[model samples]
Target: MKNPFARSSRNGDDGPSEIYGYRIYMVALSATWASAMYGYDSAFIGGTLELPAFKTSFGLNENDSTSLSSNVVSMFQAGAFFGAICGFFFAEYFGRKPVILGSGVIFAIGAAIQLVGKISALYVGRIFTGLGIGSHSFSDFGSITASTRTFRAQAQHSGEFRPRWLASKNQIVKAQKNLAWVRHLPVDHSYVVNELAEIQAAVCQELELSGEQRTLVQILHECAAPGVRNRILIAVMLMLLQNLTGINAINYYSPTIFRSIGFTGTSVGLLATGVYGIVKMATTAVFMIWIVDRFGRRGPLLVGAVGAGVAMFYLAIYSQLSDSFDRVPPSNSGSQAAVAMIYIYAIFYGFSWNGIPWIFASEVLPTRVRTIGMMCAVCMQWLAQFIIVYSLPYMVASIKYGTFYFFGSCTVVALVFAYLFVPETKGVSMEDMGVLFGPDVSILAVKAQENYQEFRRSTAMAATEAQQEKQGGLHVENA
Candidate 1:
């Protein structure tokens, strides 16, 4: 496809299709609010704590606020970690639409709890918000078949991208119905028939290879499966490294980050932090629309690591040389440059770690265990994030200039990791993920496509016979 983000109807065919339509974008937009809400609060608590009014209301002083700040921020991450784990399980049981809607409702309630102006109430609210986040959608392209997720949020809305899952459950009719509806084709249409046939065949091959029931023991065993295990490892490592980039450190404590680089005054630090957020927000859009697919995952990860690492190193140097927030409110040119480096870092991060890890993690899993595998991945991400947010305040308080250095070094390591381990997933088919990662299932997919052809032929023959019978009956009645 011209937009290689989309897959062609034919397997292994990288041609264009009409699938990348508006409905897809709308559903993508709906899932976005989770991350949007999550990000807002990750940045919100720390910034709010910096406010003189907030401190007064919360019974805290600015000088002794690090513990309080960490508690507030870390609580959210803790909730998020657990919420994400449970969300995946529930999503598997109930489906995505409920999880998506429920999380929003939960977050709204949590947000309301925070408005009560009491610390205990605030903590509970933060936890509620965490559950609502349940782990964010890793990438924008959730399902080509699920463009109407937003519409589903309305009346009678409960369908998602579940072809393989449905096929695995042997619900061939249901899978066919869904695929036909999503693709705007008849159930017997070649595109719909072919897709369902391939999906069924893939599931069959998976079952034959595993030779195990969909039991707890077997699911656990597949975790150690040759190809599946390696992809899981990659996902775990990527999630770990995603947080090691210190994006959350900036996110949770941007005001503190700005101050460490010699910017003084609450308003001044917040202004810098605001600009940093703006840069991140804008760059994220650019990455999603064009860079993610065009430049591909590996290139952005490598380049972003290089660029963001450089920016971090600069901030570290600036933090070391400057008066370290002892300067006047306006700040010096070097201090200004440090602020600029944070924005520079945001640009790189937004383009790279902000979304790539999630995308890659989602892409690498097999169909059957995709939900559980993603649950584990999401847990790792939140666990790492929780650790970062909980420790960053103390890291800044104790290490001072060393905080930037620590994060800067992580980026260098991230650069090496991306270079060594990350595979290029752009324009790759789902079947190819198994081949690329561990199991060489390309032969299986080929055989499956062959089976799909047979299925199509048999189906057409059956339809022709049924039509013939109908015509004979009509002629007899007329006579």
Candidate 2:
């Protein structure tokens, strides 16, 4: 198989035919900028809270600081909760790119508002930023899946861009060009014939099973597919586990975590967090491009869960053994080790729970319910995140090192969850999900097998035709 990351050669013999090319990869990468910004903002909050100027401006001191900091983080999450609620409308109205771009704009404005140094402005700004971030939650991996399926389906049907309805000739040509770019095919490439046919076949199969005339309510609530329900449950479970692991608690309170580990100076804590941010981004990059597909989702998640548990356990133990939460550690080694363990936890998180939930949710759902399913999953994610962020300060103040104990326990549960429920979605195409998760795979498996067989036949037929044409040209030249 040709490597999916590389652009297909013009000769058609150089790249993996089974995978996609640069265009698709570019689209996938572009979509992740939303996630990147989300990480940046989450990390930014911790560093900002550590700023003496920020604390003084907000009238914060050690006595009332934890409550104020929690409020700031919680407010962002609260805004995100409603933003997820509204994302359905935003996506339907403006589409994915617009929603993401708009979110970036809103987030930027919120950041600008925060620079003004007032609590009211800061709360309002955080809400706007949350709305933007919440809006982006819908545009993650699922958005890429939807776009790929739709573009391929449309390109297959529209062939050479004959004007449809009110669409102009220029519009038709532009659409054709764009679709060609996405598929990494020349406008008239013969390869598109098989690809389109396969997409159309899968789509027709789904419509037949799902029906074309059902009302939206019937589609969402009345459908009875054990596989579909199972898939949705997996997504929800993953999202729940993601928040329960306390990754956000760490992201939203890295300075506090650092402080608890005995970093007395705010600058020192912030500097350490900046390094943490770098590690997170680098790990996330490696996971996205290589690990997720290569290793599959379940194993990494299990490893990550177990790894996080160990790290959190160490942190919890070290914190418990320490003299005080607010004072510098009597021995720097234990505190330094605790800080290192946080970095280790981030490594475990980056490769697993960080983005796999979105990828799995997108991959596990059939086209019919993908939008609604993703919407609900993201909403749950934001809501869970809100609860975690809101409660973290209290958890820290009341229980101290016990916060890590709670998250460590959740990681153990997460391992079980992954083992029991999470299916391996590596290299699975969007349309084949029904077959993968169907009530009786023995029956549904044939559908995918038949589709593959048909695709193979098409490839062979095209190759034969190309060979014949080449031979005919040789004969004509001799004559």
Question: On a 0 to 100 scale, what is the lDDT of residue 466 in model 2?
Answer: 100
Alpha carbon RMSD to native, model 1: 9.4
Candidate 2 runs further than 4 Å off? 1-22, 143-177, 184-186, 193-201, 222-224, 440-479
Best by TM-score: 1
lDDT of 2 by residue, 47-89 (tens): 8877888778778887877777778888888887787767766
TM-score against truth, every candidate: 0.81, 0.80
Stretches of candidate 1 exceeding 4 Å from the true structure? 1-20, 135-162, 170-174, 186-188, 325-330, 439-479
Model 2 residue 437 lDDT score: 73
In model 2, what are the clashing residue pairs, if there are any? 2-16
Cα-based lDDT at residue 210, candidate 2: 68
Which window of ten consecutive residues has the lowest lDDT sum in model 1?
148-157
